[model samples]
Target: MIYLDYVSTTPLNQEVNHMYQSLLNDYFANADSLYSLGLKTSALMEKSRELTAQLLHVLPEEIIFTSGASESNSAAIKGCAFQYQNRGKHIITTAVEHSSVYQSCIQLRDVFGFEVDFISVDASGNLDLKQLEEAIRPDTILITMMYVNNEVGMVFPIEKVYQMIQKINPKIKLHVDMVQALGKMPIDLTHVDLASFSAHKIYGLKGSGVLYKKTSTSLVPLINGGQQEHQLRGGTSNTATHTMFAKTLRLALENLEQKYQYVTSLNHYIREQLTQIPDIVINTPSEHVSPYILNFSCVGYKPEVILHALEMYECYVSTKSTCSSHKSDISRTLQAMGIREDIAKSAIRISFSHHTTQDELDEFLFYLKKTLKTIKKQR
Candidate 1:
């Protein structure tokens, strides 16, 4: 199968998989136990934390491992809101965030009585900085935004936004959902207060994730039980999976530049070929977007129909974020960008991994054109 849904999740790296298997067999003790085997497992888990912190340029104490990005996002947004609500009850975020971030904010608004200001994005899914600046009030205690848009792969100006927020209110916390940016780009945590990451996105184990909370930052425990994850999250540490994630992250960063160059070229090739197809409208902006994802609309065709047609040819693609793929509604990212409902409903997202080959892309393009022709004839 020609897998084009890397944004949803990546295949496990064989090396990382091997590490996971080895660790699971050797270090099966509970990390929190006081026994010798448990102590060794706990030490290994701390080592994994240190490695992840090194990658993000943060301290070992700042990295909190979780199930995945969804849990990390929930912990960052909800935990911060609950812990700092005494300081302020208002939070700011963008409209194009992942479902996890968006829903977390919604829960704060509906259940916790916090006021949320959702900034708008342009047609290309770029946030309006001016609106963001204007939305910050004295009661704005936190700002949650995504580093890279999942649907279109638009990279948000995170550093700039953080700096701007600091200038306006140094006390306000900034939380970034960096699930899509982890291995695809260089991540600097110098200005960020908090950020979330997922291991599966970088060819690591599915159950591992990371939340970077600056040393000075504070959050209420999402899962309260034991003293795991520096008291930010509670439960028995998934020692094996977290260790495997750190190894995968290190490997991914080692080849970051090389993979970027290769993927950029592949993206350009797809963009050029897609332009030649009639009724195809590229939704992803030519600039200010990650080379890993390309979202476009087939004017007369519905996304579900196109998805099934491509499936027949063993070309797997997607309509939107994998978390929201089961929903029949239009793309929230497209709607937030002010795209027409018809175009939004017809949008298809094609994401790439470093392992995707030129020949695979060529095959996909052939099937895509054939599918379009077949659909047209049926009409």
Candidate 2:
């Protein structure tokens, strides 16, 4: 099968799998137990945290391991709101964020009565800085945005946003979802207050993730059954997965620059070929976008039609974020960029990994064009 859905999830890297297996079989003791075996396991976990922290350039204590990015996003947003509510109840975010961030913000506004301002993006999927500045208030507590958009690969200007926040409200916290950006590009979280990452997004195991909370930043615990992750999250830990986080990150970042340049050529090849097709419009912008993902629309055809037709040839792609791809809604991400309804409703997302090849892309295109022709005849 030609799999082109890396943004949704990636197959586990063999090296990371080996690390996980070693820990699972020999070091299975609970990290929190007071016994000698548990103490040794706890040391291993701390070492993992230290290495992950060093790689990400943060304090070891700052890394809070959780189930995945969705839980991390919810914990960061809600925990911040609850812990620091006395400071403010207002928050700011972009309209094109992943569903995890968008829905978390929605929960704050709809269920908890917090004021949320979702800043809209321009047609090219870039945020309006002036509009963002106007939206910030004395009560605005946090601004959560994604580092790289999963659907269209738009890279939000988090540095500029951080600078703007310092000028407007020095107290406001900045949180970013780094799932799509973590393995695709280098990250510096020095100026960021909180960030979320999923191991699965970077070719590691699923059901494991990290939330980087600055040492000085205070967040009320999101989970409270016991004292783990500095009372931030509760429950028995997934020891094997958590301990291998550092290796997972290390392998993903290896040769990243070379991998990126090679993938750019692949993306360029597909983008050129897709533009020549009838009734197809590219949704991903050419500028300030990650080369790992490309999105386009087959205007007259529903996404499900094209997807099913392509599946007959064992080709695979996706629509928008996988969190909401199963639903029939038009892409809110494309809609926020002011794309036409015909295009937005028919958007298809194709993501790539360094493992993707030119031959796979060529075969994918052959099947894709054949599917479009079949649909045209049906019409």
Candidate 3:
């Protein structure tokens, strides 16, 4: 199958997989144990933490490994809310965040009595900075925004947002959900207080993720048990997953520039080819978007119908965030951008990886065009 859903999850790298198997078999000891085997396992885990910190240009103590982006986002958002609720009860975020971030904010509002302000996005999924500035109040203790939109690939101006927040209220914490942006772009954690990352999104295993919390940032423990992950997270650490995540991240960053150039070219090719098809409307903005994802609407077709048609031809794509796929409702991200309900319901996301080949893309496009023609005839 020609897989076009890298944003959902990437195939694990062969090398990382091999390393994972080896580590899982050999270092099976509990990392928190006081025994010799446990010390060695714990050492390896710390090394992974250091490597992850080096990649993000942060201290090793700042990296807290979790199950995946969902958990990391929850830990960052909810943990921050509970830890700092005494100081302030107001939080700010964008409307186009991943379900994890959006739902976490909702929980805070519903259960914890925190006031949440969801800043609006433009038609292209870009956040309104002025509106964001206006949303920030003295009680705004935290601001959570995704660095890159998962479905539409719109790249938020994170650096600019950081600067704006610092100027307005240095006390307010900024948390970024960087799962889609981690391997696809250069990430500088200089001013970012906390950011979430997933290993599976960068060709690592599915069970590993990271939450980079600056040294000064305090968070209440999401899973309280033992002293693990610097008291930010608790449980027996998965040495295999953490080590493999570091290895995969290093490999991804090593060829970052080359991959960027290659994927951007492929993205352009896909967009150009897509425009030639009648009734196709590209939703992802031409500018200020990541090259790894392309979202579009087939004017009169349901996304599920098109997806199934393409699947028969061995061409795979996605409709919305995999986390929200069980729900048949219209795309929240698209709706937040003020897109028409029909167009939003018809949107499909095609995500690319560095390993996606030109020949594969060409074949997928051929099948996609044919599938669209078939669907149109039925209509």
Of models 2 and 3, which has the larger lDDT? Answer: 2
lDDT of each: 0.90, 0.91, 0.90
Candidate 2: minimum summed lDDT over ten consecutive residues — where? 370-379
Q: Candidate 1: where are CA atoms >4 Å away? A: 376-379
Query: Which pairs of residues clash in candidate 1, taking residues 3 or more apart in a chain or in different chains?
Result: none
The digit string of per-residue lDDT tens for model 3 on 49-90 reads 899888888899999989899999999999999999988999
Worst 10 residues of 1 by lDDT: 370-379
How would you order the candidates by lDDT, starting with the best? 2, 1, 3
Per-residue CA lDDT of model 2 for 1-379, tens digit only, reads: 8999999999989988887888898888888999998998889989989999999988999999988999999999989988888988999988988888899899999999999999999999999889999999999999988999999999999999999988989899999999999978989898899999999988998999999999889998878978889888888877888888888998899999999999999999999999998888999999999999999998888888888888888888997789997788888889999999888988999999999999999999999888888785323
Give the number of the best model, judged by lDDT.
2
TM match of model 1 to true structure: 0.98
How do the residues 84-202 of candidate 1 rate in per-residue lDDT, one tens digit apiece? 99988999999898999999999999998999999999986779999999999999999999988999989999888988987899999999999998888999888888999999998
